[model samples]
Target: MSEYHLDIFMHIPKTGGMTLNEIFKKQYKLSEIYDHDSFQKKMMNMDELTEVEKRNIKAITGHYFYGIHQEFSRPFNYFTMLRDPVDRVISSYYFLRDYPGYEMVKDMTLEEFVVKGPEAPNLQTLMVCGSQEIPDIEIAKENLKTFSVVGVTELFNETLFCLKKEYAWGDIHYTRKNITKNRLAKDEVPSDLINLIKKYNALDIELYDLAKQLLNDKLQSLTEDEQNQLKKFNLEQSL
Candidate 1:
């Protein structure tokens, strides 16, 4: 791993990142953390910043590609969450349909959105792969391996547990946010659409599976007490 002056949260869209953002905010000082909006705005002016100014930023969270790391002068740790591709695409479709800026998908049917949206396919893989064009799968896998934390949205609690152990972060508590509205239940979505999602996001499905296995492996390594602690945290969040 590279020596890092800060941690970068490469937030994948509609992957429970909104909730994680809240959790991360509590773990770092206000002066040390930049939320997504602020981070992007700051990046535009980064070239003018001195080394000390850049080093002062302890953490940055945003929806951005891997190459953002190149903009920084010092090394930084990366973290991100991956989601089940089918579910993620479904969520993204609905989320963008209503979002003010995404007029392109505003009136699109789910099918149309999946087929036509510029960022609808293999987005998770694209983000990590660090390219606008077709991404290299091996590079994406290697990039994820270098992350200080690579989490899965489906296994969010376990991911939190992994982060707690890996970084000794404070209070892993989180409440869900940015849930897609009127989402069809997995069983409710038609098989044809599901297949289409799979076809469009094949790489994301592979990446998601990799993340799941990695998370499961990390969970397996936890001591009984650590597992119990995570359980306790889950139980607390439920109430």
Candidate 2:
């Protein structure tokens, strides 16, 4: 019944993706969803899925790169949310410190983490470009065009409105998840550390700015009545 055979959610870390994942759980039956931790925990890679399993899957959500489309035989759509690089890096550092299996970062300073932490710089770009090495912004931008919707963490409500329209999803309401309460606010971080984050995430900063423009354009494309509906949605969420 859906337009695409499969819908892929590229869950970039520290980008408010967990909230979206929760909303996704409500939209699809557990059997229809292919989550990395749930349905495919034993598999080494997505390529291990049998043709029958792939065909039956309605949605796939995970911290995966953009190229997963190569593994599918049917038409698919990709959607993801990105965050400001500086804020994302800061959040990731603190969140990983407390997260199991990431004990390596427990004693690392923010500055050390920014310079050498895993998936630290231009992570959004890397995910989009599907490269572990230095990411290509142009390639990332080109790949972004194939996505059905691109959302930004800073414009979360607007992103939700777009997602609902794009997928005809029901009951988009959700509570936040995986929040890093111990992280320092961006303003509270020292100037040198802020600059250090920027220095390493320059490409991400550019990519995020472009994503914001794309999201804004999508918001502006809504009809007057639809715009009013989005406004009402925002108002309701605020309260």
Candidate 3:
């Protein structure tokens, strides 16, 4: 089987994860799992599952961050997106702070935010990606060791282009997410706060940098079914 057949689209929240997951499902017809807990909680809470259940899973999506400490490794791939920490935290803070599930951050500032708070987005980010905790570069790479095609969210279109050219897919375009319809700059984020965000989201940054280096102009390394699926969907959209 082609590497892309085992493609795993890791869900990194507040970074266009939702929109991208849709694309993978629309294109590949792979089993898409989101809301994350379905897999992470199942895998984390349970010690084992029957081989039938394992074969039933084609594409596990919706945020399994780290490498699960189990012998469930199969012919599968891994993938996710990364964004600038400063922007990610800021974006997440606004998107969910006032939402029902994120009541904790209803009135907190980035400087005031902590991981355990109700509005803690990173915690969810880790869970969705299958990691037990937040990631650093070395740790994330280790966690997603099974992934074959890792894409950078900030430059997602570029990554999609490569996936299209290399794989049988023509182009994997997706609608952007977490866009602010209005603009209001309340206060400037302190440089120190920005630095803190960068410090914490180091793993994402490293992944972005590494993906840029490794997958440059690389072709003939994609699954035909995945590629054809993407191409057909894109054409249908055009018509």
Backbone Cα, N, C clashes tallied per candidate = 0, 0, 13
**Residues forming the 10-long window of minimal summed lDDT in candidate 3:** 28-37
Maximum-TM-score candidate: 2
Which has the better lDDT: candidate 1, or candidate 2? 2
Model 2 residue 12 CA deviation in Å: 0.2
Candidate 2 off by > 4 Å: 1-4, 40-48
Per-residue lDDT of 236 in model 1: 88
Task: Pull out the clashing pairs in model 1.
Answer: none
Report residue 230 deviation for candidate 1 (angstroms).
1.3
> How would you encode candidate 2's per-residue C-alpha lDDT over 192-219 as one tens digit per residue?
8999999999989988988998899899
**lDDT tens readout by residue for model 3, 1-239:** 36424456667666677777666666543232322445423433223444654555555565554553233566665666665555666777777665677787777776666343432434433543455654344654455444455556566665665654444463456666557433223246777776666665555556555655545433245467745755665576456
**Candidate with maximal lDDT:** 2
Model 3 stretches astray by more than 4 angstroms: 1-5, 30-54, 68-73, 114-131, 134-136, 142-146, 165-167, 178-188, 202-204, 215-239
Which of the two, 1 or 3, has more TM-score?
Answer: 1
- Please list the C-alpha lDDT of all candidates, in the order they appear: 0.81, 0.88, 0.54
Any idea how many clashes model 3 has? Answer: 13
Q: Which residue pairs show backbone clashes in model 2? A: none
CA displacement after TM-score superposition, residue 11 of candidate 2 (Å): 0.4
In candidate 2, position 11 carries an lDDT of 95
Q: Over the stretch 53-134, how does candidate 1's per-residue lDDT look in tens digits? A: 5676678788888977787767788889999888888888878877888988877888987887856889999999998888
